[model samples]
Target: MNERNSASNNGLTSLSLIGDAAEVGISPSVQQARLPFTVRVVADDEALARALAVRQKAYMRHVPDFASTMHIPEKYDREEGGLVLLAEAKLTGSPVGTMRIQTNRFRPLAIEQSIDLPSWLSGRMVGATRLAVEAGGPGRMVKAALFKAFYLYCVNQGIEWMVIAARTPLDRQYAALLFRDVFGVGEFIPLAHAANIPHRIMAFEVGTAERRWREAGHPLHEFMVATHHPDIDLSAAPSLAWPGTSVDLQIPADPADINSGAGNAVRRQPACTL
Candidate 1:
């Protein structure tokens, strides 16, 4: 894998530097928040494989049948308008969480494959899918951090709506974040992309998220807007990076060369056994 040097270097800034804080009107001192794991865009095949491994493991616990098909990368993972985020433990350099964000830039969102989005929702939409985190207390933090990354990515990309298809209890989680249903309230529709499973389609307005959270006294509001997380790096992702700049993606020629350290975007941490 051939590494893109510029992407790796430019990706190190904290989330506080990515967007204008004055727009929200409640900028605190913006304290830096550090975690035991680093979340970043999967820039190479090796990172993608690690993300897939964690994805399959997380799915197997709840959806073993569906997990069977997740061992390999899906077509959506490689699509031009999409980028996969991978969270790796700082200790072992092992993937702890993963999420894929797909924009309706060149094509329709994967969720659209299952149902048509209402005409009322328009302009620069993104769907977050394949969210999975390692099990345990740390996993909870990883899930939240991944979401913060998702939200930050949307902000940087000028995305209007952040959409998702959640099932059962997961739908409740999104609700807690103030995400509203696209259809009728609590309505679950069968999604073709999700193995025909019934899921409630929900959407979040990216621009108004901070204001809504602050107004509703949302618990995660401080963590989402007031704190800065340097570990959640979206600058490596061409589609999500700083506005106006573009970089051509280069995928490794051989999938078997997983051990090749070339083109890796994962930040090196202190070595430790898993």
Candidate 2:
């Protein structure tokens, strides 16, 4: 894959689905939508700590043992080509959700430690991990928003595929988003990345997401494609610097105004509430 230097003049990447909607058979006009919370890339030590707090709390509900180790930032959280996203309540500024995205641009994906990817799965890939969200109705929205943020990040970085290793039941949620199993149909393999817990490896093609979602009459089709979410901000995100280089990720000093409704004419939707 060639290096993708598609950052705008102000140094922030734009979502490809939003930029090339017509090509994917989606409406160019996006409806402006708002959530009770804001999703953004974790840029400072305090932000990361808040993210870890939510992560640990979310995990404590299921995997108490693993949750114990999650209070502190993981090594991958600060690695090159990897970034953590945090969702915070607009009213309280408390973390509600978080996810870590790791790309194969700099090193083998964390998933690669367990199984060798098929040759057909080659090319620019990103793996979503450590996905954790608070419980309840609002948490559901936060989880969905975080997934959208992950998809947007992949599209912005010119990623070919979005990959994840999910355990049972939780994997079903990804299936609803149209991710397909990479290994076998309904096959769960032990993943070292998840503390040897069995998980189904799934992948979604980033380049084809818009087309696929539209074709399937997906429930989130409008939300994912035609909705302008100013709350899901990635302007402070570190640029996908040179490929194959061990350069550290750094947020731009003056990131682009991604929330600016430039080409997108919008209709305001009611703000979401918990």
Candidate 3:
């Protein structure tokens, strides 16, 4: 995680550094200046908690003990030294989606294995977790945007791989990113470290990830993951860098939103492995 933070900070000091695709692309037309929204990394604990609250509420709506907070900052963010990206309504400053990317050391799977992996499998890669978006996600655009920030980091870090432990079971979604399932495995999440509740082991190779995204056909989101999870395959289902990964999402009503007078955005499919 420290590596990620250091690399990102270093990019600021050295402006000549090559970063994300967005930076390379030609500027959008002036009329396009109207903000669709704004994205930023959570530099403070409060913002982190607010982002976690959104996801926690979603998890607990079904499995009561499943989740109640974004506990990474309290327990792991500092020690692990990863990064947290937040997307908010540019107009209201309401955090809408979030994803956490950290140095490979934060993955529970590797830690539980107690077996060290080669630099290619671990050091050359990072781990992405706790990805969540608000109800009306615009086919998950906000989540995709936050992911892009991580990709930019990878480009600067020169990292070559990515690993993820999913709880939501989003295989088809991930597969679209060329994240084929790598065969080997490692996993364990003691209660002492339970944040999103249950965590699973998953991984992906950069080439595979790039291929998946290139193939998934969601160009904007594809581009986002490419920069955020660059080591990830943009065109493959699951991934080859480590193991298969996916996410499960179900719709639930949030009293907070209801009180503000908005209904649940949409009724979603069950938390399937899909």
The whole-model lDDT of each prediction reads 0.71, 0.71, 0.44
With candidate 2 superimposed using the best TM-score fit, by how many Å does residue 170's alpha carbon deviate from the native? Answer: 1.3
lDDT of 2 at 172: 81
Q: How would you encode candidate 3's per-residue C-alpha lDDT over 114-212 as one tens digit per residue?
A: 334444465456777667767642416565455555554443333456765554345444544445444343243332234434444455654344444
Question: Candidate 3: which stretches are off by over 4 Å?
Answer: 1-35, 69-73, 105-120, 184-200, 207-222, 225-274
Worst 10 residues of 3 by lDDT: 9-18
TM-score of predicted model 3? 0.56
Which residue pairs clash in candidate 2?
none
lDDT of 2 by residue, 1-274 (tens): 1111221122112222122211221223434556678999999999999999999998999889978988888889999988999999999988999999999878999999999999889877899999898886667778877887787666555567888999777888788778999988989999776789899999988777777776876655655656567888987766775454243223321232133222112211122344
* TM-score against truth, every candidate: 0.77, 0.79, 0.56
Question: Looking at model 1, which ten-residue stretch has the lowest summed lDDT?
Answer: 256-265
Backbone clash numbers for all candidates listed = 1, 0, 46
Question: In candidate 2, where is summed lDDT lowest over 10 consecutive residues?
Answer: 1-10
Top of the candidates by TM-score? 2
Q: Which candidate is the best by lDDT?
A: 2
**What's the lDDT of the predicted structure labeled candidate 1?**
0.71
Q: Could you give the candidate ranking by lDDT, starting with the highest?
A: 2, 1, 3
Q: What C-alpha lDDT, on a 0 to 100 scale, does residue 49 get in candidate 3?
A: 80
Each candidate: RMSD: 12.9, 11.8, 17.2
